[model samples]
Target: MTDYAIGDLQGCHAEFVELLERIDFAPARDRLWLAGDLVNRGPDSLACLREVRALGNAAFTILGNHDLHLLAVARGGARLNRKDTLDDILAAPDREALLDWLQSRPLLVRQAFDAGGDTVMVHAGLLPQWSADEAAGLAGEVEARLGSERSGAFLEQMYGNEPACWQASLDGIDRLRVIVNVLTRMRFIDADGCLDFSAKEGLDSAPAGFAPWFRYPRRDDLRLVFGHWAALQGRAEGARVRAEATDTGCVWGGNLTALNLDTGERIGVSSHLRR
Candidate 1:
């Protein structure tokens, strides 16, 4: 019963399947932890959805920025960008079922055992200020509503650029979007953990306003795994907390990576140039 956490799929269904086969994954025993962005901006977005959804309990997927964008567009609250690969999904007959399944997935995933300590997974990252307990509580609120009929209303409030800071008192869509961005889209943030969404450049060129979220002092208390920054290309340096950047830029012609949770071993399959 090996457990693996994979990098972003980004609609690369073929690679995803190949990686599983390479590892000889058994759905009944092995578990797959997805780092998020399971769809969009690549071929086979629909196929990815169908395949992962079929995995059922064997696959635990968190929501990525692209995944959330799909929900927003489906709810008519957001526009589909030019690079989006979600058209096939939005136009598919199983769109409703797919979206429902996606929304039902959590923003944070935790695994615990009697021997080993707890490990938590989030799509992107947790704020430096948040404890694991706080992250769990906040993510649960959104997940419950996302899996409910009120999900449409939640999607409506899911889009925006304001309230870039976290406040415990925040309610409604403003609060939800902030949490989603931090958990899914975050990469670099300021000392105050204010998100720096504008700078997508390489690490050395990060703008003056931001620092990597894991760099925040208090983050060392938690054992966490995250993705969402292809720019990092899977470079993580820390002591107590393991910041694993699994997105190898497969959508931009890189490999897809998977990590063995129990052994901390990493395996990757090439994107084969995506020609």
Candidate 2:
């Protein structure tokens, strides 16, 4: 069975479909891992959500910033920004089922296969201090609440940048909020692993004390699979650690990317729709 992971869909349904056809993706045997951001900013959020949800057991996805944004908006936790393409998804007939399925996806995923050893996937990179199991445990807290009706309360508390450092002693919504942001919204961080939320520019030079989260030496254990920083362009491979940026900005006039985990082979499907 082949295992493939793709970058942010950003609601680019046309490109997503084309990528599947290019690979001749067989849902019965091949496994697909989506790096999240399944909706928003592209032309067809509703269609993208429905198609992926229809994939059922063939798909394995984790939460991304856009996915959380949709959840937060649905909970009335946040207001929709002008660039957001979520309105179409929110107004769809399958809105409830789609959102329900989306919300149920994990903040992090850890899978052990014969060739890749232990693999951990999250939307953004991880702090050096966290192992996969440790991250998974923290993610479980938010996942449990999200699986319940009380999720709105959690999503409302989810948006912020306080208590800015990781502490095992942190509890309640404040603690969980920090965890979710690190796992989803994080990109650059300081030597201390504290997040630098202000930088969006794609440059080799970081602002003062900050560095890309993956550059830190602490991630020496499992192989990390992540997207979200389109600025990185594509894959940043390290000895045992890596960042796979599948969201090559298909919605932003770039191609969609997929990586074959077993061979480290990459496949791209252009956004032009007609391949």
Say which candidate scores most in lDDT. Answer: 1
Off by over 4 Å in 1: 113-116, 149-151, 238-240
Clashing pairs in 2: 7-246
lDDT of 2 by residue, 72-138 (tens): 9997479999999898888878888888899899988889878887888889878888887788988
- Local error of candidate 1 at 199, Å? 1.0
Estimate every model's Cα lDDT from 0 to 1.
Answer: 0.82, 0.82
Which residue pairs clash in candidate 1? none
Candidate maximizing TM-score: 2
Q: What's the TM-score of each model vs. the native?
A: 0.93, 0.94
